[model samples]
Target: MRSQFLIGSRAPSIEMLTWICGKPVFALQRGTIYIVALFSTICPHCPKTIADLGQLHEKYGDTGVVAFGVAAMERAATADEAGARVDTWLNKELPNPTISIAFEHTGEMNKLWWVASGSYGVPTIFIVDRDNSIAYIGYPDTEDPALLERVLTKVMDGSWDNSAEAKKAHEKWLQGALVRRANVALSIKDFKTALSTIEELNEAIPDNPQFREAHIKVLLEMMHDFEAGWIVLAGLARDAIEKNDGDWLLAAMQQLFGSPYDYSCLPSAERFSMGKVLSERILTLCPQQDGISRAISYGAVARYFYESGEINRAVDSIEHALELVEGESLPDGEKQNYLAPLVQALAEYKGSEIPREFAEDPQNRS
Candidate 1:
């Protein structure tokens, strides 16, 4: 199903019920590159994505490039009705869009392009080369977000390598679809599906450690498979420890100590052993005298130490974090986001009431 729409495959035809602006395009024009932005009228925020296309249209229109914004997965009853609604909506959303747009009430365009390519959702973008081949298809703002711009420039300059481009685009394509599917599944509390999909995604994109953590999250927090999740996460923590990967180690520790998930379910021996390793690793990797990076790391490790009954270590860590927050590296105004949370943690660690001096919420302060 997806092979036919892979990079370098002939792009599907532009078939919409109503063409909003520019000459109605039914066939690919020779020697002209095309950029199509797919958006959903049903999505309140999809209008924002059109502006990105509009900017590009104005930027590249003179250079033999054409851009289109097609409304897909609309909620309106008829094609004409959807077209009319979209015209009014675009006028309201973008004020004056330079690119051509079309409306789709039937799901044919989505099925033909989005589903056929295994890409999902609105704001998905496609760049078609002059030869009418599907040069790229996936969400624009992701995994090497500059990929669209890079691919567009390469294709326009007659230097696109399908094998190299597809390697990047295809991975993001699978990731985007699986992420959407995982979200949909999680919304319905279909933990089984969410776990499997995230696991598949994690395996497919090993460079992204967050996906691996997400897989563990779904396993332990959503599916309540504590032992299974711990096994996977512990391996990551061990690797992070060995490699001096502070960021990955921090994420692993947060999964153990941070909330919305019940940490009590974690086995006692495994919990502290992991926390001890992570906390010690973080101490070495994130020196206390640095910027927001250290401040964040210190704050997280503080919680682990505080819970481990090392009150002095926890207090010192939080204090250093608080001091780092006030450093010149962080703007006085921007400090509140970190300050508010750290202040609360400080009061809790000290087993005292939060003083009125620091009682105000950062959000309210702003």
Candidate 2:
């Protein structure tokens, strides 16, 4: 099913049934305008947005503005599962009446609200009029009191034109829907769907640099198709080098070692060569005298050796990096941060011999 939602069109009536203080409430009533915030309970940014919606609900509930939060738990299947997620979130930290409208979707409400309500990112806010037409779509961060007031005023008076600007806004919102679907697919390791979504988006928005570049990274990580990913990275790197863009170099390095996926599969020799080049370039740019940069460079080197099956070298490199962190005159939390994982990995491996410095005692501080 196509998940794209367009604004300035008929808003689908989604049944929102969730609980508050053990009492269930229905979200839709025939004559009331509703502002809904679609969110995920686990999303790091969702709570703050939910808090803002609570404030809006508190101020507007009696007069006509009704706000609700809709969330679909990651593994939710039945109404019971959805309700359990809501209950858990409420029990822990997020408890708001606005969260009372979440329920499991059977695809009916998913199609209706996912796009029109700007569900691309959690904390997406939608202002729907009494007629169920979306009147405003935006992020809470971008929303102003005046904007909310104007929408509410128009919806209450029944005089909104649903302006030309709303149509344009809806189109822009729909474009975000495609990207959002691609991101969710990538998150779940659904490579083919993610690639297809990005490819279509790339075709539709040829001039957009952000879309093209993001798709390239998504293709590499999600598909595990490094050859194509590397080719684009190399091309982009070369272009950036010609332009002397340090930002692009950092971005290229990030794509190389940023994830848990294997770049070492490129061939030990190639991995070592690429690592050496990038490490030298990064050090020349930032020089790891401090804990953070040192840790980052150290991580790149350690990964390079580990991927190449040079466990001894990896151990030595990590030790040296940890030593640098420990030797710092100032206290930097990353020293312990970087060393703890390296120590754990080195300690756990039965096949590889730990380095001399770490072998004497596994708990030895760097």
Candidate 3:
């Protein structure tokens, strides 16, 4: 896919309904470098990204650099809801937000900049040089903090546009853009297009497990091609075992037993066999003392046993998972996040009501 905006092109104008923080920002100032950050309140990583931009602004603002944050209403259902979400995030989550924040009600800002730059996700950064030319457009967190400092210094010095690092960054941005397009296709049920995009990504970055995972999902969940999916999954499972990657094994197990895919379509015998092998491998690789990992692994095993008509073993597995969580050292809120699901699962296994303390709705938690 071709990028919509290129380095050295004129930067897009900043347009929004109202400024949520600081003075109103109508456009880029003349003869000043600007760092424009695009984000959403719901994005898990936006807080850190915004915080980093704050630091960048603190260091460069006095030196003719300005920072602006545009928060898009990506997941909000209505304009009012969007405003409220942004308010909560600013007031509660980030009381002393260091950068200027703007709210986009109609997504005009996103279209003018994010779409124009082929950016498909939040926490994207765009740098506009003193001449109002786009100097950099990519994820801000892609580079190490030290490297990013050097790159920003170059941008301020008017030498980054033609730098070798800039060219490499652009190529990496293209790859990420391709992955984003593939995900969009998947979301819209365009299986053929998604598969083709993923295939191209696999060829471009064969070592990326993300593409492999996407390929498997498209095959198994979207296309319902169990034969092909199983082959790919078996290979991934083998690789995970060889690399001692418990995370990949757990992800595979979730794909086998979780939602958005009808695993019931696969033969029970084969499904159970795959589950047993994956669960065993995950358990072996994950140490018993690693409560979080052990909890998740045992949960997967419980799901497998529960589906295989082993009620007693299913309960036993879930109980083990809960026990591990009890010994975990996570903060109370975080521990509850983990315990809530296990408690809900245990209640389901025992055919009892979900306890009040653990009954916090998943949708409400976030």
Candidate 4:
């Protein structure tokens, strides 16, 4: 569904049965510009978005711009469960509470706002003007923070919805929302719906790598059309190499090596051959100093080597990946997440059991 509340449309009422730190909040105070951030506590990116909102609130609170967070209820089984999760996240991850936090218990809030607006993911921000009209609905984080700040300023000044830039931003957001909806369809295994949605997106925005990636994923993994999928993958690889686009090359590698797709169904030799080519291209385009991308590329190449019975080459590749991880600066948890898997793979390659110290609890990582 496309968003019902467009740039000039009236925002849905904020009145809902919301729990704030285990207490009920009946309504948002009227007569102020409100930035309602719809997010999920479990989303890896939500914390940073929430922090950004908090900063926005701090900067504009006195100017009558209020930022509030509403955690979605999709993940939790009950209202109480959802409230508890929000409370924990607020306390641990976002302690200052610069912005009011609310836990959406019933799905009503989402149906009224998120679904009505065609937003399918967390961290979507909706701006409510002084008159309670919707001024903006899009991502909180942009490549240009100053541009977002200027938009927010205009939002508070009652000029954003009428601006040409607002129209452009809304159009861009709608396009992204369509892509997100297609991804949702793919996640639910509605391959036909996803296929059609992606095709529509591709036609609308021709040669978009994002749409192409989704199309290839559906073809190869869901439809089991290896012939068609390989053609797209090979073309993408060649295009990425020719353009020297490390990001697209990495995406191509993931299509072949990433989880959820059972590549064992394909001919091992051909799969390995494709993987080797993609990996070499990725390494050539993406330097070793690029850290995470390089590490991931190495891991993909290592997996290809291991499956091809080149045990020593696999060990070498994984070792180099692990060495890069060790030298890089990453959070302890994130470092553990990458290191544990690589170490486990190394142990398996060497015909030894995974060391207890290197084994990670899957439940703890996310």
Residue pairs with backbone overlap in model 3: none
Ranking by lDDT: 1, 3, 4, 2
Weakest ten-residue segment in model 2 by summed lDDT: 16-25
Clashing pairs in 4: 3-117
Model 4 C-alpha lDDT versus the unseen true structure: 0.75
Residue runs of model 4 more than 4 Å from their true location after superposition: 1-171, 183-188, 202-212, 264-270, 286-288, 360-366
Q: How do the residues 21-77 of candidate 3 rate in per-residue lDDT, one tens digit apiece? A: 876678887798888888887788888888888898899889998887888655456
- Could you tell me every candidate's TM-score relative to the true structure? 0.70, 0.47, 0.55, 0.55
* Model 3 steric clash total: 0
Clashing pairs in 1: none
Best by TM-score: 1
Task: Give model 1's clash tally.
Answer: 0
Better of 1 and 4 by lDDT: 1
The weakest ten consecutive residues by lDDT in model 4 span 21-30
Error of 3 at 225 (Å): 3.9
Candidate 2 residues 26-111, lDDT tens each? 64565777777677778778777777677777777788767767774335677676667767886676654543456554545555
lDDT of each: 0.78, 0.61, 0.78, 0.75
- Write one digit per residue (lDDT tens) for candidate 4, span 1-366: 333345557777667656584233355456888888888877888888878888898899889878878886545677778778788887888887667788677788888888878876778888878777777888755577666678888977767777898877876776776677787887798888887777777666555676678878888878988777777767766666566666776766667666466676656666567777777776675574478767877887777678778899989989999998999899888888888888988998998989887777644755
Q: Judging by TM-score, tell me the better candidate of 1 and 4.
A: 1
